[model samples]
Target: MVYIAGEEMTHYATELFVDQWIKPYFDISTWETYDLSCKSRDVTDDKVLHDAVEAGARIGAIFKEPTITPSTVQVKEMGLSKAFGSPNGAMRKGWNGITISRDTIHIKGIELGYKNQVLFERHAVGGEYGAGYNEVGAGTLLTTYLPDDNSPPFVVDKRDLTDDNNVVVVYHNPYDNVKELAHIFFGRCLEHKVTPYIVTKKTVFKWQEGFWSTMKEIFEKDYKDTFLKEGLLERSGNELTHLISDAATMQLIRWTDGGFGMAAHNYDGDMLTDQIAQVHRSPGFITSNLVGKSDDGSLIKEFEASHGTVSDLWNDHLAGKETSLNPLGLVEAMIGAMQHAAMLDVEKHPDDASKLEVKMKVLNFTETLREAMHNTFRYGQGTRDMSGPSGFSTEDFIGKVAWRLNR
Candidate 1:
C-alpha cells in the first residue's frame, strides 16, 4: 500500500481500510506502505512517489490512497519547493500505467444515485495532465517534433496570434500506450461480460482519432473472433461500436440498468469518470485501477479509490469530533490489489494446486467483505455521508462490517 495521507480523514480512512477489512483476510506481512502525504512528498523531493512506483512495478501490484496535491497556498504553508504536480500522474507514468478503470458502486436495495457499473478505460500516459504550457508574449505558436538526424522535423501545428491574447497548452499521445490501453479495455470487458463502448470526439480534434482508431484496429484484429465466438455482444448485436464523447455522456447519465464499459481519451475519461462517480452515488463508491502492459507485454495494475483525500471529513476529525468516513473505495482498491497479486502468485506456481485454494480463499473473503458492507449500508449502518446524522462513526461502521464477516 502506497498511502499518501492528507488532511485528517484520508489518513484514518486508509488505516481503517487495512484494519477492518484487509487484515481479516490476509496476513499483515503481505503488504507494506509508502507515505506520499504532502509532508512526505516534500521531504523526499517527491522521490517517495517514484520509489512507490518502482516498488509496485517490482511487486506487480499496489493499492494507493488519495494524497494532497499542493497548490501555491499549500506550497507556502507546507514550505515546499514548487507546488508539486499530481502524485497520481507521476506514478501513472512511472508505472507505464496506460488504462485507468473505474467501476460504479451499488449497494443492494439502497438508493445509490445511479445503479450502473460504468467502466472507463482511458489513455493514461500523455494528455492535458502532463502538457507543456507557459504564459508569455506570443507571435506565432508552433509545435515541432524534431526527430533524429535521419528524420526531418515534423511541424505538427502552427498558429498566428494577433497579440498576447493567446496561451497554448499542448501534448502528444504515444501509439504504443494507446494500443495497450485498448488491449486491457477489451480484455476486461470480456472478463466481466460487458459491452465495450469506444468513446471519442474524433469529429473535432483529428488527433483524437488515434483513440478510436487504435481500439477498433485491435478489437477487429485480435479480439473480434473470440468476442463473436463467445456471443459477447449478442444483446447489442454489434461487433465494434463508437460513440462521440459528448453523446456518450448523455448515454451514461441514462445508463441505469448497469452493464457496459467505455474507452475514452485521458482528459475526457478524467472528467467523465468523476461524473459517473457522483451519479453512482459518491466518489467513495468508486473502484479505480491503473492497468498497463510491461516491456514483456505482461499486464501491470495498480488500484486506488476514485476519490481524493477527504479533506472535509478530515476537518471534522481534526476538530476532535466523532467522524463517519466511508472506507468503501479504499477497501475496494485493497481487494483489487490482493486479487491482482494472487493472480500473479498463481501464475508463478501454476502446477501448485495449493495456490488455487489460496485464490479461492482470497476471492471468497473479498466478496464476503463487500456483501457485509453493502448489507450494512442497506440497513443504514453507513457513515454520515450515506445515512445522514443518524449514521455510525468510522470505526463503528467498519466494526459492523467486520462483525458480519466474522459471522
Candidate 2:
C-alpha cells in the first residue's frame, strides 16, 4: 500500500501522522512510504507527485489527502476587488466555489483509465425534493422549474443486445435511466456468462410500481433459457416465497457468501455495499464504480471513492485541532482502481501471472487499515468524542495502519 501526503502536510507532520496515528497498529518496516511534502516536490520539481501516482497505479490502491488549498479568509478580508484589481469581479465560481484543476492530481476515472469499468453510483434522493418536502409548499410549486414546458418527451428505447460483456443496472425510480442501463448490462452479462439480479419493492407497488415489474418481466422472458442453462434459476425451498425485494436481498447475501458474482440495483446495491464493507469492518476498504452504456451498448466505467470528503473533520484539521476522519473509502477507491489495472494486465499477458499477487496486495491493504483502526481505539488515542471506549484521533487511527503496513 502507498500513501501520498500532499504539499500541505510536512514530512515531519506526515511522519508524525503515520507514527502517532498509524504506526502502533501496523508494522510498516517492510512496506514503502514516500513523503511528497511541498519541500520535496519543489526539490524534485514536482516529479515526485507523478512518480507517486504512477506507483499507486502500479500497486492496487493509494490514499491522498486534500491538497488543493482553499482561498484564504485573508484574501476575502482584503476585498476581492483590491486583491485582483477589479471593481466588480467574481472571485470564485464553480462547484463549491472551488475550481479543481485536472493537473493538480490525476483523479481516478476522470483522467486515467475508466473505460469498460463497472462502477457503483450511490446518492440520496426524495428526502429533500419530494411532495411536501421542499421549502415551498408541495402544491404551491406546480411546475417546479422554469422551461418545464420546453422539455422534450420521455423516450424509451428497446433494442437488441449489442455488447458482449455483461452489465447490471439497478435503481429506484420507475423512470430512472438506470433501468435502461440495467437492460443493457443484463444482456451483456448474459452474453459474457455473468449473472445479474434486480431487487425492488414491486410486491407493494404493483401497477403503481410498474418500473421494476416491467424490468423483471423483460429479464425473465428475454433471458430465461440462458439463465436456466447457466444454473442461475432455481426454485426456493418453500412453496410460498417472500416478496421480490426480500428474495433479492437474500440472494445477494447468499451469492456474496458463496463467492458468486452478481450486480445489484441502486438503493439495494448501496445498502448491500455498505453491509459488505461493514462485514469486512472497513467501509474505506471498498471501491465503487459508475458505468454508462453507450449507444453501441459498450460501457464507460468511472471509479470514485465510496466515501465522501470528511468535510466536518477537515475544518478541524485546518484549525490544528484533533480529528478522527477515516480515509478508508478513499483508500478502497485506489484499491479498486489497482484491481482493475491488474485485471487488464492479466488479460494482456496471461503468461506472466500476477493476479494472485495483486489480490494479496489488496488484502494486505485492508488488513493494515483494519489493524490500525483497532490499535488506535485499543490504545485510546483517537478523537476525544470517539475516545470513550472506541474512538481515537484521526492521525492515531491512520498511524496504526501505517505501522502495520511497515511491519
Candidate 2 lDDT by residue in tens digits, 86-155: 1001111100111100001112222111112222223222111122322322221122233468876543
Error in Å for residue 293 of model 2: 6.5
> In lDDT terms, which candidate is top?
1
Worst 10 residues of 1 by lDDT: 1-10
Please report, in order, the local distance difference test score of every candidate based on alpha carbons: 0.79, 0.42
What is the per-residue lDDT of model 1 for residues 1-407, given as tens digits with 9 covering 90 to 100? Answer: 33334445767767776676777767867565788787787789888877887877777768777778888998998788888888777777777888888887777687776654567787777777878887657688888989878698888888887776666788777667777777888888888777888888889878888778888999999998877877777656766888888998898788776678988888889888988887776788888888866566556788888888878777777788788888888888878887887787787789999989988888888888888888898888898789998999988997898788878
Q: What does each candidate score in C-alpha RMSD?
A: 2.5, 14.3
* Pairs in clash, predicted candidate 1: 9-314
